[model samples]
Target chain A: MKAFYRWTRDLHLWLGLFLSPFLVVYAVSTILINHNATPGRDAPEETSGPVLVVVPDEEDRIRLGRDIIAQLGITGELGGVRRMPAQQKIVIPVNVPGKRQVVTVDTTTSLATVATKSPGFLSGLVYLHFAPGQHLVGISGNWFWMRLWHWMADATVYVVLFLTASGVYLWTVLKAERKVGLICLGAGAVSFVVLVCGLLF
Target chain B: MARRGLTYWNRKLHIYLGLYFLLFLWLFAVSGLILNNTHWTFVKSKPVDVRSEEPVTTPAATDDFGMAQDVMRQLDISGEIHAVNRPRPKPPHDLFFSVVRAQYFTFVQVNFDEGVANVRVRKWGFWSGFARLHTVASMSTRGQNMFRDWWMTKVWSVCVDALAIGVLAMLCGGIYMWWQIKPKRRVGIVCLSLGCVSCALFVIGLRALFT
Candidate 1:
C-alpha cells in the first residue's frame, strides 16, 4: 500500500513537471482567443512604402519573387506566385485585412497599386495565439515543435484530472473531515457534469 | 483564542476537489490527446458517405449574382441567406457566397461568369466543441442536456482562488505540524523550505507572464 501510494505521488509530480508548460500555453491561448470578452484598445502601427521591384519574365516568376521579398525586407514565407500567360499575380502579406494581398502587376505595365489592410488589436493577438509566428526570430510557424508542445498540454489535462480525483479520494480517507470533503466533492462533481451536459445537449 | 478561518475551508476543498477529479483525469488526458492529434484520429475522420440526389432547375435569365444565389438556395434547401458575394465589374466574377443553416455554415464560391461552383462546410468536432465550452461560448452541448453551464467552471474558479488561499494556510499548518514532528523527524524543515521556494518561484513566473 505504501509503495503504491509512493508510486502515485511520483507519477503525479513528474508528469506534472512535463505537462505544466503545455497546460499554461493551452490555458493562455484559450483565454486570449476569446477577444470580445477581454477588451483592450491599442492602435496598430502602419507603414507603407514603394520599393523598386523587378518584373520577371513569364517563366522565372518564382526566382524574381524570392529576389523581391529578400530585397523588400518583407517578413514571413513567400508562397508561390500565380502567373498567367498575360498577367502575373504577386501574393504577399500586406498590412491589410484578408489573409494575403494579391498584387496584380500588368504584363505590359509594371505599375503596382497598393491596397491597405483593415487593422484591429484582437486580430493580431488571435494570429499570434493561433500561429505564434513573428517571434523574435522572424517568420517561422511553430511546426512540429509547436505540435509537441500542444501534445504535452493534452497530456497534462489528464494528469490534472487524476490529481483532482486522487485528492478527492484522499479526502475521503480523512475520516474526521469526511463531511466537508464530500460536500465539496459533490458540488464539484455536480458542477462538472452540469457543465458537460449543458454544453453537449 | 485562535479560530480557524475560511482559508482553512478553502485548503480543505482544493485538496479534496483535486483528488476527487483525478478519476476523470485520464479521460481529460485521452480526450486532449485525441483533440490535439486530430490529424491522425477520428476527430477529423470524415463521416461515411451517403449520397442522395435531388433535381433542381436553374433560373431563366442568368446574371452572375442571381445564378450564384440560386445555386446556394438549392444546396442549402432550408438555410437563411446571410450574405451575398458581389464582384466588382470585372471579368472573373467574385466566387464567394455565405449562408447559415441552423448551427452550420457554408461558403460558396462561383466562377466569375462561368458559374463553376465549389462549397465548403464548417462544423466543430466533438472535443473541439467541448473546448469551446470550457473557454467561453454561450452555446454548448452541456446546456442542451443540463440546461446549465459547467457550474464547475464557476465553482472551480472560486475553488482555485480558495485553494490559493488554502495553500498559505497549509504552509502555516505544515510548519506547525513539522515543529511538532521535528523531535522524531529532522529533515522536514529543510524539505518544507525548498518546497516553499519552488512555489514562490512559480507564483513569480506566472505573474510576470500572465499579468
Candidate 2:
C-alpha cells in the first residue's frame, strides 16, 4: 500500500511537471473566455482599392473574386465570398496569419473597398487555444510545426483524464479525509452529470 | 489541534491538485480571451499564388461528389473532401468543394457552364494554428470511414468528455480544501466569495449590455 501510494505520488508529480505549460494556457484562456476579456487594435484599417479589370465573360463569381484579390494586391488565402445581388456587391474575405481583410466590390460600378484588422497580443494568445488538429480524415492546412501544437492539445485531453483518475486514487489512499473528499467528489460528479445531461437534452 | 490530521490531508490534496492543473487553468483563461475578442488581428494571411489550366470538358458524373473527385484529380490536390456545397439558387450554379490537407485548405469552385474550376489554397499561420487547437473536438463521421479511420478520434473524444467531469472535480476539491485549511480559511473564504460574486456580476453586466 505504501509503495502504491509512493508510485501514484511520483507519477502525479512527473505528469504535472510535463503538463504545466499546457495547463497554464488552458486555464488562462478559459477565464478570459468566461469574462469575454479580449484585447485588440483600437480600430480596423479601412482603405479604398481599385476594382477588377478583367471580369470573366461568364460572370463566374469565383473567377471575379480571384481577379479582385489580384488587382487589390491582397495577401492571404481567400476566407470566404458573399454575394448580395440586391446591393450589387460581392464581398471576398481574406485571412492572413494575424490579420483579416475584406474586399467589397460594387458589382454595378466595379469599384472595391478593402478593410483589414490586425490582432493584438492578447488576441493571438487566445487563438492558440483554438488550434485544430488532424482528426479522423479531415486534415487541417497547418504545416508540421503547427500540427505538432494541435497534437499537443489533443494529448493534453488524455493527460487530463489520467490526472483525474490519479486524483481519485489519491483520495482513496487518504482514508482519514474520506468524508470531505467524498463530498467534494460527489458534488463534482453531480455537477458533471447534470451539465452533461443539459447539454445533451 | 484535534483537526490537524484532516488539515494535513486537505493541504496535501489541494497542493497536488494545484500543481497538476495550474497550467491547464491558465491556458483556458487566456484562450478564452481570444475567443471572446475575435476581432483582434491574431491571424494574418498573405495571398500566395493562383494557378490555372486549360478548361476541360465537364466530368461525365452529374453528382457533386463524383465531380469533386474529378476536380481533385485534375488539380493534383491531395486531401479528403471536407464539404461540398451546391447552392441551387439561380443559374450558373457554382459547385463548391472544400478539400483539407495537413498543411493547407483548397477551396475549389466548379463552373459547369464556363467549363472551368477555380482553385484557391489557404495556409494557416502559427496563431491561426493555435486557435484551431482550442476548438478541436470529436471528428464527425461525415467525411470519415468510422471503422477504418484513425482510433485517435474515438480516444480523444472520450477523453474530452472525461475532462469536463475532471474540471468539476478539481473545482470542488479546491473549494473543499480551502474550507478545511483553518489557518487560511478566512482569507480563502474572502477570496472565493469575491471571485464568485465578481464573476456573477460581470456575467450579469454583459447580459444586460448585450442580451
Candidate 3:
C-alpha cells in the first residue's frame, strides 16, 4: 500500500513538473477560445492581385497553355484551351484548378505579364490542413502538433481518473474507513459517471 | 484595518477561484476522453462550395497578384492577402491569397493572366476547440499576459502552472489518505499500480516519440 502510494506520489510529481507549461497553456487557451467563440470573426480578410499575360501572339495562347501545363507538371488530365481575342483572354480546362498559368506576351513588344492570388490567412489555414509545407504561418491549423498536446492532456485525464478510482477503492475496501469517506466516494463516483455520460453520449 | 481587510479578501477570492478551477479539471477529463476516442464519436464536417464571377481587369504589380485578385472577385469571396512569392527554382509562383472571413480561412492561388485559379477553405470545429486549449494562443490577452508583460495569454499560462501545482497537491493529499489507512492486501497495490503504470507509460511513450 505504501509502495503504491509512493508510486502515485512520484508519478504525480514528475508528470506535473513535466506538464506544467503545457497545462498553463492549455487552460488559458481554453478560456480564451471559449470567450472569443469565433476564430474567423477576428481573422484577417482575403487579398487579391492582378493578372498578367505573356503571349507571342493572340493565337499562341494555346501553345502558351500547353507550355504552362508542362511547366506546372500537371499529374492530372489536361483540358483544351480557348482564346477570347475580343476580351484578350485565354481559358484552359484541367482536372485541377489553377494548374494552368497564362503568360500574356505582347504581339508587337517582348513584354510579358503574370498574375496570381495573394496568400491570405484563410488560404494559409487550408494549406496547413492539406499540405503543410514551408509556409510558416499555417501553424495555427496544424493539428498534428495540437493532437500531440491533446494526447498529453489525455494522459493527465487518466491520472485524474486513477486518482478518483483509487480514492473510491481506498474508501470502500480499506480498513478504518469512515462513513463520511464512503459518502464522498459515492458522490464522486456519481458525479464522474454523470460527467462521462454527459460528455460521451 | 485596510491591510488586514485586503489580505482577508485575497484569501477569500483565492478560495472562490480555487473552487471554480475545480470545474476545469472535470472539463479537462471529459473533453480529453472525447478527443482521444474521436473515432468512436461521430463528428460531422460539412463542405462549402463558393462560386462567383467578375470581369477581367488590368495587370498589377506582379502577374501572380493580378490573377489572384481576379479569381477572388469571380468567386465573390474576400480575404486578407499575404506574401507574393515568385521563386526562381519553382514554377512561376502564383499569387497566394489568404482570407479569414469567418471562423474558417480560405487560400486562393491564381496564375498570371487570370487563366488559372485554385481556392481552398478551412473551417474550425471540435478538434480546433481542443487545439485552442493546447496552444495558449489567446493567453496573450491584456490581463492574462501581465504575468509576463503580455498578461492576457499568461492568464491561462498561470492557470496551467497552477494546475501542475494542484496536481502535486492532490498527489500529496492522496498519499496522506493512503498512509492514514494502509492497505495490507496485495490486490490493492496491484490495482493502484496498474492505473499508474498505464498513465506513466502513456506519457513516457509520447515524450520518446517527440524527442
Say which candidate scores most in TM-score.
1
Which CAPRI level is candidate 3?
Answer: incorrect
- Please, what's the RMSD in Å of model 2? 15.4
> Candidate 3: lDDT of B163?
54
i-RMSD of all predictions: 9.4, 13.4, 12.7
Q: Mind listing the fnat for each candidate?
A: 0.14, 0.00, 0.07
What's the lDDT for all of these models?
0.43, 0.53, 0.41
Q: Could you give the interface RMSD of candidate 3 in angstroms? A: 12.7
Which tens-of-lDDT digit does each residue in A1-201 have in candidate 3? 778766765454344434433343344334434343332333333322233334434355345555544443322222345665675555544321112223343333433343222223222222222121112222211234433433555565676555444434433444544554445435545644553333222
Tens digits of lDDT, candidate 1, A51-149: 456675535544555555545544233334555554454544332111223344444455444333333333433333333221222222223333333
Candidate DockQ scores, in order: 0.13, 0.03, 0.05
Q: TM-score for model 3?
A: 0.31
Candidate 1 lDDT (Cα, 0 to 1): 0.43
Displacement of the residue A34 alpha carbon in candidate 3, Å? 19
lDDT of 2 by residue, A30-133 (tens): 44443345556465675666654444443655556667777776644354467888998888876443455789878788778888776644454444554542
Q: For candidate 3, lDDT tens digit of each residue in B8-71?
A: 4543332333333444465556545553454443433453555432343434544655555555
